[model samples]
Target chain A: MNSNWHEEAYYTIRTYEIDSKKQATLPALVKLMHESAMQHVIKLGVSVWDLEPHHISWVLMRQQLSVHRLPRLGEQIKIETYPSGYERLFTYRDYKVYDAAGELIAHSSSTWVLMDTVQRSLARFPGFILEMLQLAPAPELCLPRPAGQLPKMEKTDHSLDFVVRWHDLDYNDHLNNMYYLQWMLEALPDELLNHGRLRAFDIQYRAEAQWKDQVRAEVQHLPNGRMLHRLVRPDDGKELALALSEWE
Target chain B: MNSNWHEEAYYTIRTYEIDSKKQATLPALVKLMHESAMQHVIKLGVSVWDLEPHHISWVLMRQQLSVHRLPRLGEQIKIETYPSGYERLFTYRDYKVYDAAGELIAHSSSTWVLMDTVQRSLARFPGFILEMLQLAPAPELCLPRPAGQLPKMEKTDHSLDFVVRWHDLDYNDHLNNMYYLQWMLEALPDELLNHGRLRAFDIQYRAEAQWKDQVRAEVQHLPNGRMLHRLVRPDDGKELALALSEWE
Candidate 1:
């Protein structure tokens, strides 16, 4: 909140954003964090529009989120996001969510890579964007690393097939990352999803799916009481995302 | 916007709310109107929280909407909703969406009935709410009537079964109405969906679907290039909603 590199945004939990318990859903927090990221880049003059001429766009690769407790309906929440640093090809961003009472509710760390829209492959960092995200090196070392390669699923307990619809696409015309998580959550049992709660989650993206694409979401029960998930394209058999989630 | 009976709220298009063209989606407009209606009742001290103790809740019966144009992403728009009037069993509400320049972009009319949560049936209007929604009767005559009985489907061209997930439910513990519209949109052919555009719609709710229910969304192509839509529970075959849509 003190520096030009950090951007802060405020949001109120809408009725639709809550669950049956009247607490804000994890998807709501993800949207807020992403919105804050967009706001930060727009202010830094490196937004999608600014990079579009060069056919460059940001593609999310990995994300980790932990929730102390979900905020209740009508609660005013503040989101702060800033770049942690950039490695060879990935930029690190961290997010913090606080309630109106100034208590931390949730926090997240994400990794994104520059993509050449025309080539559909990772692109080198744009010098201008690198210059704007000047985070000190020491802090990046303390941040939790983005979810790395996930373990192979031993067996799939639940799986669902989803054909990407127009509503699943975002302004970027690509399926929003949030839908992947929602599909993962949907594969969970009603006893767990309705009765249990998501305590933490880690996800790593492997590919992108578009409208009308048939993608299969699979969930495996891990040995340690966690759930491992994957979104895979049925036609090409390409993995779209790999994830691990903890339930309370 | 001029009177206490009228509630106005402003919204900015979000990245997740727009289609590939960067124009706001119909579901986005629906959320805005509902949010504005919530704001209106909150101001009148008759919000859901206040009525919960009485085991009563508002249930949408019918809605009609027309769009002049969908707002672009990041564009600021204003939504105004007010109670148009109320008959013995139904309360009427109207919504208008305007862009920053004050040009009308979308308008809607809706009818709602009160439900007794304990009894699971229609309930008489509460005395307090009846006093707040006082509109002069003359203007009510000019407003378009809420969508009445819809023509039965001749034959379903496309159908999709959607198992209501935890994310699909709202604070009311019932499936959000927006999801019904989304499922209907999903049932349309990609040839019509990806290329064609929705210009207007009228929907009437027949029953409420809760979590874990498998509802089938079916759409039939009409002879006049329109579409007839229905959301029905596969168990009891209860019609959840009947809708008609006109596309550009």
Candidate 2:
């Protein structure tokens, strides 16, 4: 992607941001992407908080990350994000991660929706926001695969239960969507975690988890070096998210 | 503390770094303190990674934070760190947090030790490091209070169990010490968390939580607006850390 075509930011992988092998962890990258996207929106002259009086906030519906190589600890990487227009319900954004040499180390595409905080339902994109992000979608970028097409829960090979903690919450007082992704990855076998490097992953957030909600993350092995995962609120039997990951 | 007397850095709290009230959380401040200290150590001409050759690493023993108020979202704050001096086995460092107006918002004192990573035991400070940091201990500073003096667990008022997940592990393959503080705070009463503001907290690291350790966090209420906490590895009955917190 052309560097001038989108908003760009640079981040140095901090010591704590990396894993055992000194490679930046998935959570760190996800945080950067969100931060960058949020900043772009602010620069576009609208802050998410500006929608607060209207009881509206942007929520991630789906995100797909493709990692060619994870940056090392202290490695400075550049990120570029574009609010690549909107469809009927979801607004699309794309991100590109470049190394010092300007090589594309990773890229991601995400779909987001404006949520009605009070009603806990989807809100139509505001006309102002639509105009602010009306840039044409990147022809080179592909949409995150529809969440429905991702595998459903099958026989669970591994599972872990977690209670949403205060730190896991955001200003919305709901469990931040990022923790679901962390729990999904954490439910994987320790052997794979210690040995494998994640190459790509897709996450689709389906439901919101509240503070103190007891949630379970379950993973199933799929054919051909892939894994399918889901996070569910067993109390209500609501599936919170679905994800697919591949590693090598 | 005079600005010239210590190494300083400024950080603007990011969106996700704040709480529901838009105040920067404890974890955010702790991270900035450690980052500034690490950079100071590097500037003194030796990187922590350089110590790897000798199988040595620096470890936090205790930290005490006094917060007059927490900085809010989008606020730029200044942090100053001073590696005061070393005692028989512990090295002392102090941090001061200031608002944009230079008013003190928070301050912290920490005790640390060099550890033989393989042995996981305290190691004597290296001669070169001693020379680099021999700058006189700040006269105005006081040592972090002895951890043993913190209240012992009498009755557990609230408790929560957590499994050390993959993301919790640092590069050393041990649960990064910050998570203990987070868990300790998380186990508090939800009402207190929602309505109260934390005034101060002191944490002492006793042991490391490894990947997949099933750990339990217990908190006990004390008189005069205080609380005590302990994080334990239930399987082996090991106390990983102890903390005391006060709120208003």
Binned by DockQ into CAPRI classes (incorrect, acceptable, medium, high), candidate 1 is medium
Candidates, DockQ: 0.73, 0.73
Residue B68 deviation, candidate 1, in Å? 0.6
The alpha-carbon deviation from the true structure for residue B3 of candidate 1, after best TM-score superposition, in angstroms, is: 5.1
Expressed as tens digits, the lDDT of each residue in B169-192 for candidate 2 is 877889987789888888888888
Candidate 2 lDDT for residue A199: 88
Model 1: DockQ vs. true structure: 0.73
Candidate 2 regions exceeding 4 Å error are A1-6, A137-148, B1-6, B45-47, B141-148
